[model samples]
Target chain A: MTTFFSVAYYTFIENIRKKIFYGLILFGGVMMGASVLLSVLGGQQTLRILLDLGSSAIEFFALLGVGFSAVTLILEEMESKTIYLILTRPVSRFHYLTGRYAGLLMALYAGMLAMALMHVSLLLFNGWVFHARYVLSLFLSAEKILVVGSVALFFSLFSSSAVSSLSFTVFFWILGHFSGEINYLGTQIPSLAGKLAIGIFYYVIPNMQYFNLRDFWDVPQVMGNWVWLSFAYGCAYSAVFILLTVMLFKRKEF
Target chain B: MLRLLVISVVLFSVVNAELARGFAYPLAFSAADAAASYTGLDIASVVMGVRKLGADIAWIQLLQYYGTPEKPLDEDRAFQLSWDMTKYLFGAKIDKEVCFTAGCDDKSHYHPQIDGGVYPLFLQYCYRIVALDPSYYFTYLYGGGALAWNLNRPQEALLLLEHGIAVLAKYQHASVRDIHEPYWQLNLYVSAIVYRKSGDFTGMLSLLETAVGQPDAPNMIKGILANIYQKQKKYTEALRLWINIYDTNDLSYRRRAEEKVNELKKIICINPDFSIA
Candidate 1:
């Protein structure tokens, strides 16, 4: 456990030192400004447009942080053979993958926090009424991104660094949003075999619509069946895929 | 056993974070606007190069641009747009002169269209959002609704819905959005209603006729068509549809159908040649 924490802590420190982290945080702040610019284009939906832009900016930047920075941090170490040094010394494969995932999440958390603070401040300054639910929803939003990171990590084992990172990103985004379409297709194709195939595809993809609280930004959130359940489901799903990643690493040679 | 428990604990702890976050957000300090309001979608924004999701970026910006406090209502378009940054950050109400101006009548703040070529641009922005991500069905509904109802431009809404139906048919001709659609119907229902709103009731009737002919048209669509007939004073045709509604298990529909039937019977007794509708 200490080994895991130490690895995660150091990896976070190393990632924090990267210039891209600062660039991402800075871009999040710029999005707040962009919201003000955008709010003007909106007539009655001014406040909404502002917050939506802020929220989307956070999600977009965090996604980039994971794909461009987090995945690269892990894959590059392995690609450049730096993992061999740590693996030979005393660190196990499980520790390496888990620690890296934990560290990247911590770093991503910092980014999410900074951007969220900026976003909330802009909303407050604008006198916009917000429910405490934004926090729960935002946390879930971060979790969704982390799951994407886990997928990226799993892909890192089998593919090149760039390919792994980019593939997970495209997959995470499309599958998350398009689960609705998959459901639509499920009913369209009448063939029994086709229906079964579509059903499997739908279950295999992440249903991001659950965490899509943006459409309900102003609506108060209850720990209702959908909200808390979606959060729990995300964690369980991420854990399984990440465990699969660990399993893949377990069998890999130097 | 311990290792499995440890993993479960860790994952479970992540779930707890949501509970903790719900309690802490209100304590956060409010922040002022960090930067000045940018003018139009200037060269800077345009040239920045959308390394990804260009249409989405443009779509969001378009939303913000329309929602801004000093919506472009001023007689002098360029001058009104030049409202100082302080005016925005300070949260000043729109200038009286701007509101009184011809293009700026937004008393309710739901100005879907202000003159100065802004409102009409709703369709254009919808075009951009759709072009960027063609599978986004809701945008079509939104763009269709705004144009048909708010802007009084059902023609544009019809065209947009036409495109939406074509695109959606490719992926979701059949769907499970129960309240939104029933099976393969209502994809074209949106466009049909827009026809009705634009005073093309004949066009609306014809579209519904086509929908009625379809083997899978939902009952809701059928009821709506029947109601339109009642409004148009087609008593006999409406009576037959009302009987269908009365036969159904829906109490509310049944009650309304019975009342409508009784009223239509009296009208039919007076006018034998009631083809005026």
Candidate 2:
């Protein structure tokens, strides 16, 4: 456990030190400011508008940061042969990959922390009410980042460059939001063949929309189970991707 | 030992937050961005005072704010926001996507959605935009037109159009502003429809009067105003405008004016002061 954490700690620092990390953070801060500025266009809807903008900015920038970092930290290390340093140590490949994933997750959390503080401050400054549900929304957003982080790591193993892996991760992130509708269509289809084809498409996709709490920020129906259900779903989904990533990494000559 | 405790708590808190997240789904603080009393408009009020340019930027941000919709759950709401925001801010007419032409009876005519909840804020947004840049003419046209035609809230639409007319009147009269006399008359015409809907007969006549009185009123204005009076059964008033249009000799309106003048002559001859309504 200690050996695993040591790698995680090292990877976390390396991920945070990147220039893009700072850039994403800076961009996030600017978005927070913009969200507050745009809030007034809302009239009586200002609070909901601000909340949506603030949270979305955080999610968007943080997802980018995670996607880039996941690809770069893993793919770059393998390419440069620095990954051997950890693999040759007491750490196993599973631990090494898990550590790297944890590290990237931590870096994302740190960024999310910064964004949340800025968003909360803006909310307070604007005399907006604080809803505890925002924390859940932010948490779900972080979980989404983690899921995308794992996806980025998985894609990096097969895809050659950071760009390709990041691209795949973003593509999946977008497609996952449509998973619910696709799954609904599967149920609607009459043929068993059609249902199976769509069912496979539905489950195979990460269904990242499950973690989308932004839309449901105000709506209450069918969300009673979101807390445990999304947590289990996000964890199970990310774990499967990470396990695949670890298995794929083991096959590499490095 | 204490350091370990701090780390343990940090990890536990992270885990607990997720647990509560699922369990709480939407906790108290998340449901509403604020209590009923706490609105961000107060902050906007302050920002507009200090940052004049920021207000302009804020207007853009407002469009951005409006365009950004939460998803999965907010798909409908956000979709409306983007649709309306585009139309209101940019003057892009958004046709209802679901409408079908003649053969399909059920979907033949499109009824633009009127989200009652979102309707009230329409005027408020347009007012703020104009307040920031008083000369921004499109805001008034698009917002006022939307309120009247789309939202079916004619009263609010009339108020917005009137405010726009008032703001442009001085510059419009001087022919200095980009807003021309036709634009003024068009706004009044839109207001006239609102007045007609609200059962305000005098208001509708007043609107037509205002349009007809414009120095640069279109050559057809007298005919149009006369037609309105003819429908109201005010043959005397109708005759007067018809005569004015007839004197213009604008071929497009002359025939209609002459026909209306003859029609009104017969009516006035019958009673000398016949006012059907």
Candidate 3:
């Protein structure tokens, strides 16, 4: 456990030093600030636009940060022969992989937190009434980013190239948000094989709709047991991908 | 590796199913109903789970379309002073002065021909907007009110309101037996439009009064009710509504409200206690 946390700390420090990390954080802040201009066109819904657009900018930039970092975490190490140096020490592959993932998540979430702070400040400047759901929405967004990072890491291990891993992760991201449509299609299709195929796709992809709490946070009676279930689902999905990533890493020649 | 892969797949399927059973969203991604220009946006918003942002874009587009001066149908007379252009440039104050200087009577100035024209694509814009984000209550209110009163198309307004109510029903709690505020507000708009369609002016006026009294009622509704009171010669009531609209500080209505309040005050000074029903 000590080794795991040490590896995590090292990875976190190293990843934050990259220029792209700082660029993403800067871009997120600029995006939240730009929302003020966009909200002008919303007429009476200026505050709503500010709140929605700012939160979306935070989530989107965090997803991009996680995707870039996760897909490159292992591939860059292998390319630079850094994995051998780490493996030569008294550290197991499980600890190293989990630690690297934890560190990647830490850096991405730190960036998200900075963006969220800017968003909150902007909202307050615009006379936005504070709601507890704002925190819940940010928390759910972090969980969604975590799932994406784990999936990207798994793809990096299973695929041959970082480009392919990134492409697969993005494809899955789109499919995940479309899971509701896939479920609807499963019921609408008449053929048995088509239904089976749609069913498989539905279950295989992560359902991003489950984490889209920001869209309906104001709705009454909608956040009962479902919120907890969605959280559990995010954790279980990430764990499955992480475990698979470990299995793939164990078989590598390096 | 193969055994672990199988285990991962099984675990993923089980967890996903459990969440799927308990979770329900009020989204129905239907590209069939959207305008051709907005179909791509509608699909992208649903696929990317950014429906609210897409709706905002559509809302802004609608505002721009309605806010712009309508083009003249006759090519040769296009540059001449179109009524909409006159209204856009001078607003109510200068437009009224221009009409009076041109020897126009009060009836002709106040009641422009309802059948002179309508915005052809207003209902289509409303449909495209709500199709992207059905929970956008303002679209329903603004679109319905504009259609029924401004465009003289109460039937179309009722149609839009019905669609809004039906779509919003999906968000209602199953066993709560109580309606949400947006849904109830929409029903109120429907009844007011119904009264308007039947030419029951008193009924429509009373219903609108009730609507504007709600805490969440929009300034647009207040403006509409004030105009109605002004038309009926109820100067005191008109002044009260205009004052309320000015206090809201909504930029879209503030200038017009200020003008109405000043104009109504002058009319009331002549006969301080006089009011017509």
Candidate 3 Cα outliers beyond 4 Å, as residue runs: B1-11, B30-37, B72-117, B173-178, B265-277
Task: Please tell me which model should have the higher TM-score, number 2 or number 3.
Answer: 3
In terms of docking quality, model 3 is acceptable
Off by over 4 Å in 1: A219-223, B1-277
Query: What DockQ, on C-alphas, does every prediction get?
Result: 0.05, 0.04, 0.42
lDDT tens string, model 2, A1-254? 88789889987898789888889889989987876546545333345456666777788788878877788767788778887877787788878889888988898899889988988998887667787888887888888887888888889887867788888887887677666557668989999999999987766676565576654444323245556567766776677677777778878886
Cα lDDT of model 1 by residue, B1-277, tens digit? 3466467547645554443344221111112111112224422322221211333455556554544434535666545544532253334544432221236565643232245333646777776555544444445655665565446677787777777666545434333343234213445567477667777878878877776555334334555666667678787777777666565433323434555666677777865453212
Candidate 2 Cα misplacement greater than 4 A, ranges: A188-190, A220-222, B1-277
Candidate 3 collision pairs: none
Q: What lDDT would each prediction earn against the true structure?
A: 0.62, 0.63, 0.79
Global CA lDDT computed for model 3: 0.79
lDDT of 3 by residue, A1-254 (tens): 99899999999999899999999999998887788777776667778888888888888888899888899999999999999999999998989999999988888888888888889988898788788889988888888998999999999989968899999999999998888878898999999999999988877788898888887665545666778777878887888889889988988987
What tens digits encode model 3's per-residue C-alpha lDDT throughout B1-277?
4676577667667767777777777565555455425667767876777777777878878876776546434754343335544443333343432221123455434222323347888999898888777777888898898898878899989989999887767666542533477788899999999888888988998889998888667777787788778888998898999888777655555556766776787788965553322
Model 2 DockQ class? incorrect
Please tell me which predicted candidate would have the highest TM-score against the true structure: 3
A108-227: candidate 1 lDDT, tens digit per residue: 889999999989988988777777778876887887787778777777765655775687666766676666667778999999999999987776566665666543332222235457
Model 1's interface RMSD: 15.6
